[model samples]
Target: MYNALMGTAATTAVGAGLTLYYLEKNSAHANMEAEGLHPADYPFPQKKLFGTFDHASIRRGFQVFKEVCSACHSLDLVHWRNLVDVAYTEDEVREMAEEFEYTDGPDDKGEMFERPGKLTDPIPRPYANEEAARAANAGALPPDLSLITKARHGGVDYIYALLTGYCDPPAGVEVREGLNYNPYFPGGAIAMAQNIFDGVVEYEDGTPNTASQIAKDVVTFLNWAAEPELDDRKKIGAKALLLFSSLTLMALWIKRNRWHTLKSRKIAFNSPKNWNKKPNPPSKN
Candidate 1:
């Protein structure tokens, strides 16, 4: 009984909370639902050459990661093995794997093994643990970059947008207390300052070391991280669905043609069963 009451109360609380949130954001929510103005609705802007992923661009992004963000943030979910899917060669991946240090010890035979990193090794944290990370980043632990493209409101597009959106606060916009001035952040300010800046990292790609380029390339790399096989997955899914749909349609057509006969036969068979199963008027009592 107590569990039932608790469940009821929890459901009521959730309903009430949702009601309040909806009331507060009714206009935005309505606009998003009706027009798909939500984060995932934003389309990735792609051109023939500049927008799409390539080796030079991803390599440049790696350079950016190494020079800037990798000091604090860690992409714990992404393994070095996955880099091959993102256009890295096996040798390049091996070379990259050597950069990260991993922990391993002797086996039962007491033979030492070099267990720094491998193709299958997940990205390790820069800090020892969450407590250490929080202590360094002013109480905000840096999020893993592996799933960042999908986790954010606009996915890769949002990261691209946010990176390029850094600008001066608009005129007449009241700067809220405890908030530094920013126009692009969803909440007008973030603890993280302008991350992408010009001439920050020297790219081996020979592209100009502009903040905009870095931001765009990094976002592209992140998109790759989130869904490396998205195109292949989508293609396979489409083909499978088409086959299933065709089979279903054929089955439906056959069923439609045979429905009357099947129904008649079922009725004929069911009558005897019903008659035999009947109570026989309770033995005429």
Candidate 2:
């Protein structure tokens, strides 16, 4: 009886695996014909600027992160060193680095040398590590933000949408007991609360006290955090493309010469002057 049950379970597992594999392989093709939805289709307002970092927006985002999100969510993948790329001067970056305390220590001088962060310091976490985070969140781990802009769907668009998309008493929508309405979220709901509010964090930059503005600013910072080298990368890509085109032209020239030589050899060998007899052409199937 046990063996018979095991055989049935194995067959079920095999069938499920095959079904999953088929769906995975054909998903892209299936979606190709489906209409793609933008973030604006939901309650969220999409960002005006994308794929490029906005300094003002990022600066504001830093404030939002410090005030609210940083309380529970930690940016472990980001280092103090990486902040330099977001238009922060070396001095500003260093000052920012000192704000977060880290794990490493100094040598035998007996004086605690404060670790001044470099451009590569992975952002330290409030928790000791992932295990601690999981424990706190009821096993629901909060993802690292360093690569989230790239990792999430719609990438930056998705994040910006999620931030501003939070709302209470969502009309025409039923939310799960614990989950809150977040129109920007893929499923239109999330476990996290609507964290942003007007005048939530006072800005020295004279930026307005509005939820939308704050969300946009924070999203901008996240985008820059994900790709500090975006501007430089664009420049590098352009240079590489030009170089590749030049090399491709040279390769074409070499290929032309090689083919020309082969054609000449064939002509020389098959020349009427060199061949005394006519070639046979007729064949029966």
Candidate 3:
């Protein structure tokens, strides 16, 4: 009886929770529609199991982040060595690290001192701590770009849309100070200003640095940073699939060959009465 009562109570609670959830979801959707906000879609390049990343785009995206996004956002998850061979040569990576002034330990004085960055060092922070970051950005903390693509709901497409969605608020909409209108953001008002603009960063490879192009590139880089082992994972998956497929085919072939004779062989059957009659007929002959 206790178990039955417990089960009934649990079911009732779950049903009530589900009812409330659906109610809230529908209310939210209605609110969004009333505000002229809809899901923003962007054409994100697909990543395939057999395909490799576009390294050139990644490099350009890194440039965009370093020049513009790095000022406010942090990429502490990425290391200077990660860029080696993927985005830059060893010499270039070394040079890039040297450009940053990182703090290192003192030798004899037991004091921390500033020194150039090393390959193993994490990407530098824009501010000393979260307090400083928020203070500088009017109390809005800039999220880390290293995993932003994965952290968001729609991944790369959502990021791309958000970056390019900044525009004047709709008629009858009043945007607060320090807030910019963006259709892709949840409330249609974002703290970050319009960061991407045409010719914002001069592409080193001479590609046109349009706003859309920059947004796409930076999103790609963030996606790559979020999943740095994507290429290796894909390659291993493809190889494993190929190997398993080949083995399955070979097993099928061997099974058919082994069973061919038994499958094709003919068999005959006779009645017991016929055998008994055959012996009587032979004796008469």
Best by lDDT: 3
Q: Tens digits of per-residue lDDT for model 3 on 1-285?
A: 999999999999999999998765444554672353443455555454366678889999999999999999999899999999888999998999999998889858999999999899998989999999999999999998889988987688778888888888879888899998887788788899998999999997999999999998998899989989988888898899999999999989987998889888999987776665544455554
- Per-residue CA lDDT of model 1 for 117-212, tens digit only, reads 878887667899999998987777778788898797557666766666656666765655434444435556655666789998887657999997
Best-matching candidate per TM-score: 3
Q: lDDT for model 3, please.
A: 0.86
Ranking by TM-score: 3, 1, 2
Per-candidate Cα lDDT values, in order, are 0.70, 0.70, 0.86
Error of 2 at 15 (Å): 37
Question: Could you tell me the lDDT of residue 230 within candidate 3?
Answer: 85
Q: Which residue pairs in model 3 clash with each other?
A: none
Q: Each prediction's Cα RMSD?
A: 11.5, 13.3, 9.1
Instruction: Tell me the deviation in Å of residue 158 in model 1.
Output: 1.6
State how far residue 213 of model 3 sits from its true place (Å): 0.8
> Residue 190 in candidate 3 has what lDDT?
84
Residue lDDT tens for model 2, 1-285? 999999999999999999998765444433331222245422322233223456766777887887878866878766665656464678887887777655455558755555655556766566777898878766667777777888876777667677776767446668878677765565665777778888898888898969878877777777777777776777687789999999999989988987777756743345677477777888976
Worst 10 residues of 3 by lDDT: 33-42
The runs of at least 3 residues in candidate 2 whose Cα sits more than 4 Å from the true structure, single-residue gaps closed, are 1-38, 41-51, 105-120, 169-174, 239-285
Worst 10 residues of 2 by lDDT: 41-50
7: Cα error in model 2, Å: 56
